[model samples]
Target: MQNETTKIALLVAIATLIFLLVPVFLILYIRSYNRHKKNHFLEKQNMQQKFESEMLQTRVEVQDQTMQSIATELHDNVGQLLSLTTLTLNSVNVNDEEKARKKIDNSLALVNKSIKELRELAKLLHGEQLVESGIGHAIDQEINWLNKAGTYELKVNNHLVDLQITSPDKDLIILRLLQEIINNIIKHAQAKQIHIDTYLEKNKLHLKVADNGIGFDPNEMKMKKSGMGLNSIYKRIEMINGKLVLNSAPGEGTSISIEIPYP
Candidate 1:
């Protein structure tokens, strides 16, 4: 009887230990998961903050560029128009009825022309309202601007033209992404050729830009955290629930692919 009692007590102790250990293990697991979740959220927030700051700086630069063009227009075009209108008004005479009427009409016409030109300048003051027609035309416009340089041999296959859906919000962001990529190429790529392809497949929009440029190791960029250019791209991609793939190596050139959900 004594031996049987000892065995039974030993088994009970073993069972109690396992029961307590199961809950302990479960609590530790929950704590670990919660920590990971918190860290992810914090990282996302930091990235967003950085992206917003970068965007602010970019907007300021755009405004500065725009102001330069506006100043030129004011001097060369609008100023001349306004000056002519003033001369016409000053020459108006009441002595001769027909002459007075003609001068007044010319002045009115000149003033109206000036108003129209000023209105256009005002619109441009908004820092170039791009993609106004559609995403397709917008990309074409960017391509045309790049072509004017006569620097890169370009090959473009853009299927986004036939796409009927419109996502104005995403369109602007995507356009900016392309601009940033192109800017990087111009500043750093030393690229001789560029190939751009945008299309729709499997309910996702794909945009690819490849350049035969002097490439750098992407891993090194990440390790160095090379400024906000790449980080902004990644953060904006995340915000739109998009994906980006970047491939590059020393002397191998670079290719970037972006996929985003449609409207």
Candidate 2:
């Protein structure tokens, strides 16, 4: 009788211990899962931040190099040629009717064309005005100057919506993104006509730049990393808390629309 009582007590104690241990184990498991999730999210954020920083640095470096090359061209080559042409025209005698008149006219025309090209190049090289003049005017000026070359056509539908909403950081991102997109079209699109439309809707800025260029399959482009320009533009947009949509197909040309919400 005593042995039976002892056995019953022992079994009860064992069962109670298992019940307690089960809950403790479950609590520990839940804690571990939560910790893992937190770590994963933090890691993802870190990676995104790092990517944005690197991209911005790379873009600035490339822009600096381009500006340097353009400056050298404008100061050393074009400026020297124009000066020499002016000197030659001035030295010619006006009394020689036919020869002097013909040479002066030709020189004058060439100098004017050179000056126009140089001005366009200077505009393209300038990056500081993005923050100074605000985004709308800066972008409009760029489009107008770009059109002067007649290589690309630009059409702006909604023009009077220049909201003072861009931060210095955001401005650079926007400018760089636009430059990349335009450069891409010039390089790969073989695009003749480009259209740009900007509008403000519901406190969000929307910009659309489209080209009637030779388009390709997005899937193939992604697979081969062929659309570096598109990739750069989209990534910059993402960095700035914006969303980008790319629409295009082979022979259909391409259009990219970016929307950014302002706080």
Clashes per candidate (backbone, < 3 Å): 0, 0
Candidate 1 lDDT over 42-117, as tens digits, reads 9999987876776565556555645765686688778998899888888888898899899899888888988987
Determine the C-alpha RMSD for candidate 2 after optimal superposition of all C-alphas: 5.4
- Deviation of model 2 at 170, angstroms: 1.9
Error of 2 at 257 (Å): 1.4
Residues 38-109, candidate 2: write the lDDT tens digits.
999999999879867766685585477458647766786678768878887887888998889888887888
Which candidate number has the best lDDT?
Answer: 1
lDDT of 1: 0.80
Sequence-dependent TM-score of model 1: 0.56
Full-model lDDT for every candidate: 0.80, 0.74
Candidate 2 Cα outliers beyond 4 Å, as residue runs: 1-52, 58-62, 65-84, 87-90, 94-126, 158-161
Off by over 4 Å in 1: 1-132
Q: TM per model? A: 0.56, 0.67
